[model samples]
Target: MKQLPPEYYALLEELQAVDFVLVELTLYLDTHPHDYDAIQQYNQFAQQRGLLKKQIESKFGPLQQYGNSYSGYPWNWDDAPWPWQV
Candidate 1:
């Protein structure tokens, strides 16, 4: 079986936190759609998640590029060490 990179775990943790914040803000916005503070905070956190996602992709290759690249360094989805090995 293939192992995930260490950064994968870190990114997953961050993604989870961001997901929670997004969900909470979504619920809050449902009742207070015009609340500027909540909207701003949600936007901020959403941007943070985007940045983290980009970082992960840059380091690990595109998540959806499952076929693996073969030019310089092989984008080894099959052999890229586990999350604990980052």
Candidate 2:
């Protein structure tokens, strides 16, 4: 198996954590649409998710096919299985 830097793993975990929180908040907001606090929390977590995705891509590489995989640059979908492959 390939080994990645510890920080990459940490960032991945943080991203997952943020996603989970966002999911929970979404569910809560669905049932309580008027709860402004939950809506704010959900929006914050969504932004965090986007930022984490950008950070991971900037630090490591693209995590999917849509991220510069075919933008006349080198193909990177198969570059780092250590961080994405299970």
State each model's C-alpha RMSD to the native. 5.3, 2.7
- Looking at candidate 1, the ten consecutive residues that score lowest on lDDT are 63-72
- Candidate 2 wrongly placed segments (more than 4 Å): 66-72, 82-86
lDDT, candidate 1, 1-86, per-residue tens: 45665767778688778979999999999999999999999999989977876776666655434344332256455555443344
Candidate 1 overall lDDT versus native: 0.71
**Model 1 Cα shift for residue 1 (angstroms):** 2.3
Per-residue alpha-carbon lDDT of candidate 2 for residues 1-86, written as tens digits (9 for 90 to 100): 55678888899999889989988998898899999988888889899988888888877777657443232247556564645474
Model 1: lDDT of residue 62: 52
Q: lDDT values of the candidates? A: 0.71, 0.77
TM accuracy, model 1: 0.66
Prediction 2 global C-alpha lDDT: 0.77
